[model samples]
Structures are given as C-alpha cells and as structure tokens.
Target: MNQPARVLRMSYLVASLAGVGFFVLSVAWLGVWPARRLAEDAKRTGPGHVVALTPSEARGRVIYAREGCAYCHTQQVRFTQADIARFGAPTLAWETRADTPHMMGTRRIGPDLARAGGTRSEDWHLTHLYAPRSVVPASVMPPYRHLFAGGSDAPRQEARDLVAYLETLGRARELAGDEGEARAATVSHTHMEGLTPSPVLNPHPARPRRTGEVPALPANGDRARGEWLYARNCAACHGSTLEGNGPGAGGLTPRPTNLAEHTYTDGRLAQALWNGVSGTAMPAWRDLPLADLGALVEYVRDPRITSQLRHDRTRPAQGELAFGQRVYEANCAQCHGAQGAGDGWAARALAVAPTNFRVQRLWGTAAMRILQTGIEGTMMASWRSRLSGEEMQAVAEYIVQLYRDEQDLRAREGRR
Candidate 1:
C-alpha cells in the first residue's frame, strides 16, 4: 500500500519469475534438449538398430494409458531383497533410457510388469487375463476381459504388442553379458555340494550304468491296476485325464505343466515316471515295488481304456487316516500350514514358498520322490530317514485325499 512496500513486492515478484524461468531452462537443457540432440546425433552416426513401432503397439500404449495400468503395475524395479526375491533382478537405467515420457510407473498394486514377455506362453497370458481366478485363485487383481472384443480374442494382435512391449522392458544387452557366467558359477556350486547338477549344467558327467536300467514291465499288465494306481496316487495333481488341471493347480506358482503338450519318447516317459525330472517338483519313484512301478509307467504311457487290466484296488492296510493326521499335525503342519494351504509360519522367511497340498499337480508323479529328495536350494529337507516308508506312503495317500476334498469343496462353492 505504501511506496516502499510496493517497491519491495515488485522486486520479489521479478526475482521469483527469474528463478522459475531458470529452472524451466535447466530442465529443457538436461532433458528435452539433450534428447533431441541425441536423436540428431544418432541419425548422423548411422546404422544403429531402430525398433519400428507397429500400429497395434502404438494403440496398445494408448490403451495402457487409458486403462491406468500404470496405477497398479510399476515398470521400474528397485534393487532390494524383496524385489529381487519376488521378481528376478533390479532394473538397469539404460533399459528405459530410450523411453520418451518414460513408463516408469510409481504404484505397485500388482507385480512389476518389466520382463513380462515370454515369461509364459501366450495361452497362459490369455487365460490369466480372462479370469485371474482360473489361474491364480488367490490373486486379488480384477479381470481385464473388456479389453478384448466381447471379452474374447485373447491372444489378439494387441495382446501380442503388449507382451512385446513388456519383453523389451529389461536391459537385454546387460543381461546377455553376464548371464552365462552367473549360470556357470551356480552349476559349479551345485556340483560341489554332491547333489545332481541341474539340466543346464554343460559338459555333464557321464551317465552312470544304473541310469538306463529300467525294471521289467508288470505281468498280466492290467489297465485296471494302472487306473487304480493313478486314482489313488496320481489323480490329485495330474488331473483324472493327465491334463495337469488337477483341483490343486490354482495355488502353485510356475503352475503345472500340461502333460498333453509335452513330447517325450516311451523310454523318456518311463524314465520320468520312474526317476522323475531333476531340478523340479517331480520326484523319483525308487521305492515303489518294481512290478507296481512298471504297471504305473505303462498306464501313464498309454492312458486308454484298452490299456486297462484288473489289479487290486485295496488301500494299504496299515495306513489309518487318524494316524496319518497325527503324523501331519506333528511334523508337517508347521511349514505346510494347518489347512495345507502351503503358507506355514516359516513360509514367509523362505525364498521359494512352501508347497500347497491343495494342488495335486505339484505333488503329482512321485510323492515318494518329494519325500526322497525334497526341494533343492531350499529348506525342504528330505524326510526319508525321519519317517518310515509306510508312514511316508500313508502321508502321500492323505495328501491325495486332501486334494480331492478341496476339489469337491470348490465345485460345491461354484454351484452356490
């Protein structure tokens, strides 16, 4: 209001304007100006790989923005134990350095979407997006069916573009540099521990003589025997049709493999059935009687009614459910959970979570194998010496029953 006060106010306003203008100029210099200069430089530099954006990809980017996917799924991954433990590794600055208005999302309502490309086949992505409950029953994320035409056309051109964009999120150049060295070191460490090295181990040791030796097939090879064995032993996880959609499939990570798509020779199938696939959840069936093992193998190899022959359907006489319950409560409940959801008290501390008994596909193939070898690089210790073979067998049978009960409950709930 006064002359001196007005003069001071005018001076402050000028100074504030100058500061704001300088800040804007600094940002332009560091960000927009350099990026434009770099583009011009790259053009003159010649012959650099330039990714041409497809029409669908451009549209998908628009869709991503419109849907506010950035609100839930962060593109950036921080370098931390929790991040690396859940996801694979930390993000590199150069990976997103090329991005204009970079899609480094801030919120993390879902897992980071970086490196989502090729994580699973297209079919899995389609099924997952259509109904998250169908794949991961526990996922709280909402379905995105409206994105497709009438909620159909999953695996559409747009889906492919989205997947491609996700695949391009990681620092591919940096990963290629050190992946081999890291893998080699891991293999060396595993071998040093006297455990079977992973399948990726190169220049693998010579196959021992016992590797090729398979026991003889069962006499009077009954298809009925195989069916009964499967129902009692294998049906919990592999599903009744061996499609790998057993009632328990929903809870496991890395999910169950659909056996129908798998290609293996009769011998290889037999080997998998008998010895199990190393470095995975599959377990070796070394303890099953030689004839019973052969019968089960034949049944799985040729799962047709014509393969059926009569065999005993009798349950093991010594396996009382009451006794098995006692054993589970005493020894298994701490890690597998009281309800067998695989989230025991100790599960949170583990890098790879414990197995959910509700999913049979995880425990399919050889229950005995899991009891024999346990999981590798984790605390799932072998229980062969801790429990008697009969007790182990009883526990396996109980697990199968538990899977069936869960399936029945789910079906009943669905009807409601």
Candidate 2:
C-alpha cells in the first residue's frame, strides 16, 4: 500500500475525480445556490407588485453598474439597528426583484441608496451629479460632469435615464404601503426584534420633508453661529447674498427662494427648518440640532436680511384691497386657501403645496415678477394672461398684508 505507482492507476484517477467533485460542490453551494435563493425571493417578495424597469431605467441601471456606483453607495439595507434607524426598515429581498446582477453591495463608502427614491428632487440630483461639492460642501463624491452638456441644467439623455432609475429605488416597497410594513415585520422578526416602525422610507435630512412637524426654538439664538451654518448649508443653492442665484441654483425648478427678499415669521422658519418646503428643492434641516436651527433662524430673521424687503415694499392703495381680495378669491383661493395657510380644498391633490402667505412675505417687485412669469417647476402659474399688471400688484400687496401679527388685527381690513 505504501509503494508509489509509476504508471497511472485507480488511486490516481480517484483522487483527481474527488478534487473535481469538491470544486463543483463549492460552486453549487456558494454561487448558484444563493442566486437561486434570490430568484425565488424575487418571485415572492412581500411587495407583490414589483415594477419592471422601463427602457430608460434599464439603461440607467447599466450606467450605474458601469460607473461602479456600488463601490461607494450600497443598495442593501441590512438587518442592523444602525441601518434601520436612518433608512427606515431593512431592505426586503423582494424589493429588489428586478435587479439582475443586484447592487446589494457590502461596502458603504457613502450612504445606502436602497431608499433613495423620492428623497431628493430630479434637479437636485442633476446638480449633485454635475458637481457634488456645490450642493453638499463636505461631500467627497467625484463630479459626474460628463453626464451634462454644460451645467447641471443641461443634463444629457444618459443622465436623465440614470436619475429615472434612481427614482425607482424604493418604489415597490412604498407602493406596497401598509402591507409592506407587515411583510417587513414578518420577515425581519428572525433577524432583529423591536424594530422601529417608520412609514417613511428614509428619515435623513436629505429626504424632502412634507409633514407639518416643527420643533420649538430657543428664545435667543446666536447670529454668528447661524451665519456660519447658513454659509455652509444654504449658500450653495440660496446664494451667498441669499438671492436664490447660487452656483447650484441653475438646475432647481422654481429655483431657490430669495431668502433675503422674503420676510419669514419665526414659526415659518421653524417649519422650514424642521419640515422643509414641500414640492420644491428645499430639503429639511432636521438633522441639525435645535441650537443650530435656532441660530439659523436668528440669521435668517436678522434685520439686515429683511431691510431690503421692508424698504422696497410698496403696498397697494386702500381702494385696491377689495379688488385684490376678489382677485385672490377668484384665482388663488382654490389652491392657496382662503386664509392663505396652504390648506386649500384642492391643496392635497397638488404635487406642491400652495405658498403660505401668512408666514412668508415677499418683496413687492419680486412678488409681481413671480406673478408675471409664474414659478417654474411649481403649480404657481403666471397671472399675466388672466389679470392686468395693476391687478397682480394689488393681489401681491394683499398677500403681503396677510402676514400680519395677532395684535395687528386692526390692519386686517387695511384700516391702518
């Protein structure tokens, strides 16, 4: 038995066959087995209505894979406490039913993109893709400038396709709604118990906030600190001078608000800071601490910021008040509400909520211009075709008067 065989024998053949058999077993156990499991899960996903990719979305997925996007951002939301906290529920196997090769990466050099759909606006995506640092100053993401013809506004077909794919990241799960939550609970019970029950896909500041939740600010705020925060976070889209002409503003629809030209009530600032303006590119700053948010409020409400608007405002004559009221009731009340609190009968049906005139007042000229041109990328349409220039001016001024205080009821009828 110990003697070596010089010629090929049964033992030699047996050893070779065993080695080949083990190799096949490894491949079957590791690769093919897991892939089959994925396929099965895809078929029976909790969200039964998994949407197939459109041609554009498919093209975008190819571009995403080609760009090696998975290296930085992961599509998988693992069953961990940390992942669940920021990104809502853990990713379901069925959520990614359409993913062929799958983008469930292990590394998270950037945030997980499993719930990226509907978090940011398309224009925001375009600007960020064109130049990451412009929108997010601290972002380490390399610019995908080649995706655009010029700036972010001029996105190529490839860029549009990629964005379309991004918008579908968490669609199936969202569409599943309550059933998906129940499914998540059933499926995730084995991995971790006491999971957070969040209806929203992602709870991060990057998510566009549409809720009415607002945090109470401190009585006093540090203007200097607020200024610093504003410069870092807001200046990119709102402009250094708060003119809505920042480097990243080109891509945004309706553009960024001219912060300096808008007189914002404290409550308005709080709402904006906590929940962000719905239907626009403005994202909530809920990630910021209360103190930091307070500081920003102070900076925004600073006398310097409001000075230009206050002095430039030219209120309509007393005679125009009734005319303005009639004009507003006829055209604006259906969406903007009778009281201008952004809670009109048809407000819920709109993609973008009507502007709350009670909380935010714009300068007269800027208001008129907005009325003339209408706000692009929003439901606010031009009044140029419907109303005369004087009528627009009257309604705009009336809208400004709507921002008065509780004690200023004396001016409610423009008597003051």
Candidate 3:
C-alpha cells in the first residue's frame, strides 16, 4: 500500500471511533442520565410531588394516546400572561414527570387540557365526548359516539377510563393545595418573564361559584343586533325557531330550555349567560360584550312574546278541571304556591325555586313527560305512580290555562 492510502485508512478509523464515542456520551448525558434523575425525583412523596397514577388512570392515559386526543388538545399550559390568566399557573417540570411519552400535544384546536381535572363533572365530559356540539353549539370536535353504549349518559369502560385519565391531569399540583402555591411563589423559577405567580390559582373560571346574586341585563338592546348574535352563538342549542329543538339538544340530560314555551326574566337570562348553569354543560360567556349580552336577551324574549306565545286551546271538561284543581292543591301547591306565583311555603326550603306557573308555559307533551319522568337535577319527582295517566293529562291542561291567563293579563297591562 502507498503512504497516502495508509494515511486515509488511518484517518477513517479515527473518525469512526470519535463518532461512536460521541454517540455513547450523548446517550448517557441526554438520554440515560436525565431519565435516571427523573425516575428518582418522580418517586418523591412531598407536598409538591406528582402523585402516582392509579391503575385505572394509567389505563386511561393509554386510551387517550390511542384515540389521538393529543392531536387536538395540549396538556401543557405555556408560560405566558394569557395562558396563566386563562388556565391557571404555568405547567411545572414535575407536573409531567410521570408521563412516559408526554401528552403535551403539538397543536390546540381545543382548549388546553392541563388543568381540566376538576373543571367539569364526569357526566359533562361524557356528554361532550359523545357529542361535542350537544353542549357547545359551535364546537368543531368530532363525536366519540362509539365510546358510548347507548347514549351520552351510558359510557363503556374505555370511555370511563379515558375520563378518569382526564380527571388526573393537573390534579397532583392542585392537590398540593395552599402549601404548594406558597412553595411555588417562593421558588425563584416560578417568576418568569417578570410575571409574578397569581396568589390564588383558579383552574376553571367557567365553573360556577355558588353565589346567590343574579346578574343584571343591559336595557333597550337593539333587536336586529340581538337576532344576529343569537344565530351565530345560540341557534345550534336553542334552535332557529327558539323551541329548544336545536341540532345538539337531544344528547343533553334535562335538555335545553324550550325557549318558546317559557318566559325568562331579563335577570335570569343575563345570569345564565354570565355564570352558566351549574350541573349542566352550559358555559359562561363572560367574554361577550355588554351590548351583545343585551342583544341576546332581547332576541330570546322577542320570539317568545310576539310569535310563539302559547295560548292553551284545550278547555278540559268541568269534571277534568275540578279533578286537576284538586290534585294541584293536594300535591303541587306546597311548592308551586296556591296562585302559582312560585312563592309556596316550600319555595324557601328548595335549592332551585319552583317555576311560577303564571309566568311559565309548558307544551302538553312536555308537561306529560315531566309528570312521568320528573325534572332530573331538580326538586320535582315522578308523580306517575301517584297520578293516573288521565289525572296527569288534566293537571297539565290546567297548568297551561293558568299560563294563558297570565299572558292575557300581561298583554292588557302593556296596553294600558
């Protein structure tokens, strides 16, 4: 062999060995060493330590990845003012220490899932997964209907596991409680980009606080604007006809309000939008402008008052009316009041006050169903066992007549 050929061969051998050495060092420092450190630290059982996932939650995590939920939802809350304000404190390193292949997704087509642990009830999550639009009118999320056995209410084991996994996200950090917050505040690293950590971390502002005060509605709203707002934001759940038969209505338990059948006071409408109904999928729309809020209220009221005012055409026989009156006095009067003004003796004792029959209307079929099934999540109970079908029909008709009388009186008062 020539001298130049031998030199080239020698250089190639040296280069190959150097490349192999670099690879080994990189693996040790970047891959093995960090993993060992993480394993040691993650086993910690201190106040700020991430809790080990239960067997069910671990299984759920697998399901979450299998379903490709990570493609749309991110488990990380970025270190920014907007993120902190919207989704609590920024995610810490320990928060994701337990995840094998981290679920910090690449994109965010939906809201961040980092602090979704206690934001909503399990039922709400199940319903949302089964049919996203059922609660969120404009949600673009695809339905996971296959996860359910029958309906949104009936989720199979995988569905339950998936929900269980979701319930674990950011839970450990929250479970850390006030001490964790104080610890985080004391840590120099917690302050980022000159941003101070919030004293109280509110993971979910959308969840309702149990306050009794009702929000006030804006006055003299423009109906045209209100109509536009309603079509854009509310029509999917409330229906174009304001009948609560919107495309997404069927999956919800207790269902959407039959806007055409009921008269809601301005305060009720305003408060419902502002705070969202607790134990339901309704979300708070605090981001909406004051004018828009007023407009929505006006739009909701206009159709009910002008076009959809239900006057009970069913005049029951005298015997039926007498029987209905007798049943109402015996059973419903304690909660509905003698005059149906929602001021019965039992009203104060109930969490949700009874509906004033004088101000509210119910369709015959709906009233019948209420008599049979009762209103879930309310003080109302099924009277199907106590009242015969005929009695239920008569009482419903009597209630409808009461609504008609009240409507007439209101109209007369407006004219005067």
lDDT of each: 0.56, 0.82, 0.75
Which candidate number would show the highest TM-score if scored against the true structure?
Answer: 2
Number of the candidate with higher lDDT, 1 or 2: 2
Runs in model 1 deviating more than 4 A are 1-52, 149-155, 171-243, 246-416
* Per-candidate clashes, comma-separated: 8, 0, 0
Lowest-sum lDDT 10-residue window in model 1? 201-210
Candidate 3 achieves a global lDDT of 0.75
* Model 1 vs. true fold: TM: 0.39
Greater TM-score among 1 and 2 belongs to 2
Query: Which ranges of candidate 3 are over 4 A from the true structure?
Result: 1-52, 133-137, 149-154, 188-190, 196-200, 203-205, 212-216, 305-309, 312-369, 377-379, 387-416
lDDT of 1 by residue, 1-416 (tens): 88999988799889999999999999999988978765654343322343544676666666667667788898765555455444544444444556666677998877787655434434345555656655444677877776455432335566566645554544342344455335334323422353332222111111112234566555334667777876666554466777667654443333454553232334444565664433333435654566666677657656653222323234544537667777787888888888776678977776445656664332343566677877544577899889998777777656555543343466799999
Q: Residue 17 lDDT in model 2?
A: 89
Q: How would you encode candidate 2's per-residue C-alpha lDDT over 224-337 as one tens digit per residue?
A: 999999999999988888888888898899699888778777788888888877777788887899999999998987648556455655556788988899899998999989
